[model samples]
Target chain A: EAGVTQSPTHLIKTRGQQATLRCSPISGHTSVYWYQQALGLGLQFLLWYDEGEERNRGNFPPRFSGRQFPNYSSELNVNALELEDSALYLCASSLAAGQGKPLHFGNGTRLTVT
Target chain B: GESVGLHLPTLSVQEGDNSIINCAYSNSASDYFIWYKQESGKGPQFIIDIRSNMDKRQGQRVTVLLNKTVKHLSLQIAATQPGDSAVYFCADYLTGFQKLVFGTGTRLLVSP
Candidate 1:
C-alpha cells in the first residue's frame, strides 16, 4: 500500500499572502493530521481531521486551518502567511484517531514565505 | 507550557556501537509514547512506541524503554550504522487526545 502523499514538494509565497498545501492519506486510512516542522525544531501539531470533521487543533492561530474530504485527503490553508511560516508542513494518516496507532507521514511540503 | 524535552541536543557515536537517546516528558497523563527518526528534509518515520503499561519494547534493532515513575523515555539502537544518522524525537499522546506533543529532538551522528 502507498504511504501518505503530499503535493507541491516546495512552495514559495510572499508575506501576507495565502498558501494551500494538500495531502492524500494511505489507502483505508480514515484520520489525517497536519504538523509543522520549523528549521531545527521539532514537529508541532497543527490540526487533526477524522471522518470529515475537525477533531482537534494545536495552539496555532486561527489563520492555520484545514479540512479533510470524504476520501480522507486533507488540505491545509495558511492565511496571512508570515516569514515564520516558512517550514516543512507534514501530513500523517492513521487507521483511526485516538487509538494509539502509529501515524504514517508523507515527505512533507516545504513552504517558504518570503 | 509543559512539553517533552530531550536530555541532550546531540549525540555522537561510532559505527557498530550502541546509541541511546533520552527524553523527559512533563505530562503525567500521557499514556502513549513514540520514537521517530527524521532524516534531512524528510518527515518523521516511526521507530517504535510503548504504552504506559509497558516498561520496555523492542524492535528489530531498536528498543524503547518507558519509565513512568520518573516520566522518562529512551530509545536505544544496536550496532548503529551510518544510515542511523538523523534527528530522533519522542512524542507523547494522551489517552483521549488526537494530538501528539513532540520532544525537542536529539541529533544522532554516527562516525566510521
Candidate 2:
C-alpha cells in the first residue's frame, strides 16, 4: 500500500501572501494530522482531523488552518504568510485517533516565504 | 506546560557501535510514546513505540524503553550504520488527545 503522499513538494510565496499545501492519506486511514518543522526545530503539531471533523489543534495561530476531506485527504492553508512560516509542512495519517497507532507521514511540502 | 524534550541535542557514534538516545517527558498522563527517525529533507519515519503498560519494546535492531516512574524514554540502536544518521524525535500522546507532542530532536551521526 502507498504511504501518505504530499503535493507541491516545494512552494514559494511572498510575505503576506497565502499558501496551500495538500496531503493524501493512506487507504483505510481515518485520521489526518498536519505538522510544521521549522529549521533547527522539532515537529510542531498544527491540526488534527478525524472523520472530517477538526479534532484538535496546537499553539499555532488561526492563520494556520486546514481541513480533512471525506477521502481522508487534507489541505493546510496558511494565510498572511510570514517569513518565519518558511518550513517543511508535514501530513500524517493514522488508522484512528487515540489508539496509539503509529502515524505514517508524507515526505512534506517545503514552503518558502520570501 | 507539559512537554517532551530530549536529553541531548546531538550524538555521534562509530559504525558497529550501539547508540542510545534519551528523552524526558513532563506529562505523566501520557500513556503512549513513539520514536521517529527523520532523514534530511524527509518526513519522520516511525522507528518504534511503547505504551505505558510496557516497559520495553524491540524492533529490528532497535529498542524503545519507557520508564513511566521517572517519565523517561530511550531509543537504542544496535550496530549502528551510516544510514541511521538523522534526527530522532520522541513523541508523547495523551490518552484523550489526538495529536502527538514531539520532543526536541537528537541528531545522530554515525561514522565509519
Full-model lDDT for every candidate: 0.91, 0.91
**CAPRI grade of model 2:** medium
Model 1 chain A: ten consecutive residues of lowest lDDT: A95-104
State each model's C-alpha RMSD to the native. Answer: 2.1, 2.2
iRMS values for every prediction: 3.6, 3.8
Candidate 2 chain B has its poorest 10 consecutive residues by lDDT at B1-10
At residue A78, candidate 1 shows an lDDT of: 98
Residue A38 shift from truth in candidate 1, angstroms: 0.9
Q: What is the interface RMSD of candidate 2, in Å?
A: 3.8
True contacts kept of 2: 0.60
